[model samples]
Target chain A: MRMRFDKELEMLNGEIEKMGNLITTAIETSVKALVNQDMTLVRIVNALEMEIDEMEKTIEQHCMTLLVQQQPVASDLRLIEAALKLITDMERIGDNAEDIAEITKFFGNKTFINKLVHIPQMAEATISMVKRSVTAFVTKDKELALQVCYDDDIVDNLFLTVKNYLIDLIRQDVNNGEQAIDLLMIAKYFERIGDHAQNIAEWVIFAVTGEHMNTDNIGKTK
Target chain B: MRMRFDKELEMLNGEIEKMGNLITTAIETSVKALVNQDMTLVRIVNALEMEIDEMEKTIEQHCMTLLVQQQPVASDLRLIEAALKLITDMERIGDNAEDIAEITKFFGNKTFINKLVHIPQMAEATISMVKRSVTAFVTKDKELALQVCYDDDIVDNLFLTVKNYLIDLIRQDVNNGEQAIDLLMIAKYFERIGDHAQNIAEWVIFAVTGEHMNTDNIGKTK
Candidate 1:
């Protein structure tokens, strides 16, 4: 029975890792789609989002079943709880990616609104945070999880840079206002995705140390 | 043992309902603050947000303990799972409200943005959805849950109205761009709050009927 429980636990870990990979791919694809104005990549991100949803529900059911069948205590319980929370964050990341894709579709064929430098950089940092945070969970690496939390600052700073740049663009020419607002919203979405990734990392920390990272002001924007 | 489980389930129900009320108040106050330009109410909304966060963590711990100690199965398992998911949505509602308050603070003492009609209406609809969705859960009323899902359409429609109005205002004069975008964002946040409430209602339906509401495209903007 103990062996069977251990095997099932291993399976749960595998499922979450798979979901994490799908989410990171979706985020990366969404940003690439926006920067390049590529509809095909946007479609792919949407498709990836649907798959992520299915994976989220599947992992959720699997975790519940484990809780019921095994009645896991101590670290086992924490692992299952963390898995449940992590998937929700993963699903939100997918949703935010889809949001970015939707906005990209809205901007279809529109002229470039300044070179998309900081936005892409922000997306890369957020995607890395997503990947490493999940790896921290799968490997029980607390340091990696903490590092993911720290990287959120980079995403946040880039968001401010994007905001200020867009504001300047809007001020210079009122015609740029619409696209500037759209770009600002896109940056905000990426920032939110970063927060969700940080939330996953916090849960990873919780799973490892039995203490939730201080997330009191987590979603607040500067 | 069965009676004890029933009692604990009732306690869980009560806890979630309480959280739901606090969330709705926060939503309402944030909107009122925005409409009236009242800093006092904004502060109140922020304070309520902190309490809502505390309640979320406490109830989450309680649910985890219930799961670990009782090992509830079948319908009871569904109830606990639904409650767990509900609080996450509820906590998000609080966060979104706090976000609205933050934006309201940003817009302090600003002049009128087209009389603030539909945004308030959207807030009202969202607060009702939040309240009724939780009531549906507490009563195990699938119809009410379905109704909450239907009501989301009203909020979505109001969002479009708000968006169009802001667009027209921005087009009329370039100087209105900043406040117009801010108002649009506030409307977007309320739309998001409504989505979160509808999500809670969907979980209610799931608890009662063992099927998640078809939320495949939920949170997608038109």
Candidate 2:
């Protein structure tokens, strides 16, 4: 019975990792679509988002079944509970990527208002945070999860830089107003992605240590 | 044993309702601060958010304990699981409200931004949605929960109206760029609050019917 439970736990972890990979790919493809104005990649992001949503439901069912069938205790229970919460955050990351793609559709073929510097950097930061948070969860690396939490600062700073730059662009010419607002929204989405990643990492900590860190300010944006 | 489980479930339901009330008040206060430029109200929103966060942790602990201590089956398990998920949406509604209040701090006694018509309307719609969603969860009213889902369209339409108005404001005067962006962010936050409320309502539906409904696109903003 113990061996069977362990096997099911491993399967659950594998499914979660698969979901994480889908989310990472979605974020990457969406950002690539935004920077290149690639509608094809945008379509891919949308498909990936649907897949992520399905995976969330599937994994949620798996967790529920495990809880009902097997009397998991202590760390096992923590892992299952954390998986439930983590999938919600993962699904949101996918949605955020899809939202970026949605906004990118409005960009058309026009040249960007400025060089695509900080937005791509912000994407990279969030992607790294997402990837590492999931890795920390699967490996139960509490230190790596802690690192993911601190790395949020990089994404937050990049978001601030992007915001101030777009604000300046809007101030420079009223013509830049619409595109600038769009860019600001995109940056905000990436910042939110970073927050979700941090939430996943914090959940990892909770799963491993039974302590939920300072999550009160997880999604609170500056 | 069954009686004990039901009693615990009732306690959990009461706590969730309390959390919902905090979220509702936060939304109302945040919007009031935005419309009135009331910094005192913003401070109040912040305090309410902290309280909401504490209640989330407390409720979460309650849910986890109930899961471990009781052998809930069928609808009982569904209700517990749904409660676990509903608190997340409630917490996010609180965060979004606080975020709206955060932006309101920058408004700083500015004069009428074109009479603030649709924004207050959006706030009203979302507050109603939040209230009804929570009541739906507590009372297990699937019809009311479904109504909350349909009401999201009202908030979404109001958001578009507010977005278009702010864009026009920015186009008309470059000076309106900063405040217009801030106002747009506030509207987006309310829109997000509506999304979270819809999520809670959907979870209530799931608790009642075991069907997740059309949540595949819950947070997918257009």
True contacts kept of 1: 0.34
- Chain A TM-score values for every predicted structure, listed in order: 0.96, 0.96
Interface Cα RMSD, each model: 2.1, 1.8
Off by over 4 Å in 1: A216-222, B112-114, B216-222
lDDT of 1 by residue, B44-157 (tens): 999999899899888888888888788888788898998887888899899899999998898889787578889999998999999999999999999988888888888888
Which candidate ranks first by lDDT, i.e. highest? 2
Q: Pick the candidate with the highest DockQ.
A: 2
True contacts kept of each: 0.34, 0.50
In candidate 1 chain B, where is summed lDDT lowest over 10 consecutive residues? B213-222
lDDT of each residue in A1-222, candidate 2, tens digit only: 999999998999899999999999999999999999999999999999999999999998898788777868889999999998999999999999999999998897889989899999999999999999999999999999988888888888887788778778877888888889889899999999998999999999999999979753444455
